[model samples]
Target: RKDIAVIPYEPRYQSAFKALNEEWITAHWEMEEPDHKALDHPQEYILDKGGHIFIALYRDEPVGVCALCKKDDPEHEYELAKLAVSPGVQGKGIGVLLCRTVISKAKELGCKKIFLESNTLLRPAIRLYRKLGFKEIPKSHPAYERVDIQMELVID
Candidate 1:
């Protein structure tokens, strides 16, 4: 992970972000409407809405991505979504780096909490979330049907 650095999304890495996320989403389940909306227009869907997307670069090569999307809720909650690491370098702590960086970014932006939705089939991701201090919460109106579990980390 020495050479890997997580940085904010840039126009140059737009396609890479979409590709990385599409690979994983399609691998597990078909892309949903929400996926299309976010992936197709990250700037408008995320950044323009007061959200943040961070990209992981290894020696200048795009390899991972994570987004903290501002939610429509009353309380200042952000949705941690679209986290994907390249398959070629899965266990190099890239995903952990992205998660930790995004969480820190959320706190700096005065976020009260960060929430995420994931399916039970993605146990590794769930474990990572828990390790990052996110606790499971009762499901509400999930964006996708694949989301069977919802978690949130209070930015204390």
Candidate 2:
């Protein structure tokens, strides 16, 4: 992880976010409408809506990305969406770095909890979420057809 750096989303990194996510999502499931909404217009869908995205740079090149999409939950929660690490560098701890960045940003934004929708087929990602202290939660009505399990992490 020496060369890894987690930085806030910028317009310049938008393509990286979209491409990285598309790569992973397409590998397992077809791109859904929700995916295009965020990936295509991150500025409007995420940043302008008071959400945040983070990109992991390996030696200054974007290799992974994650987002905390603002949600309507009255409990002040955010949806942790669109996490992806380039396959070439999988298992290098970049995902953990990106997630930690999201958790920190949620605290900074005074969020009560962070949640995500993911499919059970993604064993590695599910494991990572558990390792990051996200516990299994009742699956919500997901926006994507692929989500089978939902998890959440309560923030202090």
Candidate 3:
């Protein structure tokens, strides 16, 4: 309870979101193509589409962010995207808290399943996903050509 808070995205968090993306790219996606515009646009879209976006705060300072995107598929699924914790605070429990928050938010949204894509380079994150009850699934997303692993969780 040490002043960790998760709140919806706001315009004021653009800088923090950018910082998080930079950290994530540097740490886990060094070989992948960097599409700055694509990265920047999703935060705006998530905020505008009534999607759930959460930022973790430590004593009022932004330290992490996560978002849930409603899938267009008729299966009533969701996508968990952009879950990032500050590089400076990586080992703490903030990432776990952020994930739990997203799962709860997904359940609240009536999502029966949730999916995410990750590269194999992110060993820590992959382990975290497994620990959180996510299971590896066959890759089916067309937009994620570089993803080495796909995971899904049944929320219902």
Candidate 4:
């Protein structure tokens, strides 16, 4: 975690975000319409809509990316989406840094909860979510067909 930092999304990091996410999406499942929208237009589809995206940089190079997408839930929930760390550095705890950043940002924004929809194939990601205190919830209609499990973390 040395020299690694999580920073707010910037237009300059657009390509890095897209590349990082696309690598994982294509590896696990075909890129869906929702994935295309979010990855291609993070500024408009996410940030402009009151959501936030964070990028993890190791020694100033973008290595991972995550997003907190605002949702319509009246309880003020944010969907934690598009988390991906480069394959070369998978076990290096970059994802943890990103998740911690999201939690801090969500609480700072006064969000009541954070949720995510993911597929079972990503066992590592699921485990990370569980370790971060996200409990599994009944699966709901999600944007992507790949999502078989939904999890949420309530912010107190």
**What TM-score would each prediction reach against the true structure?**
0.97, 0.96, 0.86, 0.97
How would you encode candidate 3's per-residue C-alpha lDDT over 13-101 as one tens digit per residue?
Answer: 87787678678776645523333543576555665665777889988999998878766777536777778898777887788888889
Candidate number with the higher TM-score (2 or 3) = 2
User: All candidates: CA RMSD in angstroms?
Assistant: 0.9, 1.0, 2.4, 1.0
> Model 4: what TM-score?
0.97
Per-residue alpha-carbon lDDT of candidate 1 for residues 42-149, written as tens digits (9 for 90 to 100): 989999999999999999899999999999987537989999999998989999999999999999998888999999898889889999999999998989988999
Quick one: ranking by lDDT, best first? 1, 4, 2, 3
Lowest lDDT sum, 10 consecutive residues, model 1, at 70-79
Per-residue lDDT over 1-156 for candidate 2, one digit per residue giving the tens place of the 0 to 100 score: 789999989899999999999998998889988889999999999989989999999999999999999998875479888899999989899999999999999889888889888988999999999999998887767789988998899988
Better of 3 and 4 by TM-score: 4
Query: Candidate 3: TM-score?
Result: 0.86
Candidate 1 local Cα displacement, residue 63, angstroms: 0.4
Off by over 4 Å in 4: none
Per-residue lDDT of model 4, residues 24-134, tens digit only: 989878999988898889988999899999999999999999999999887447988999999988899999899989988999998878989998899999999999999
- lDDT per model vs. reference: 0.92, 0.90, 0.77, 0.91
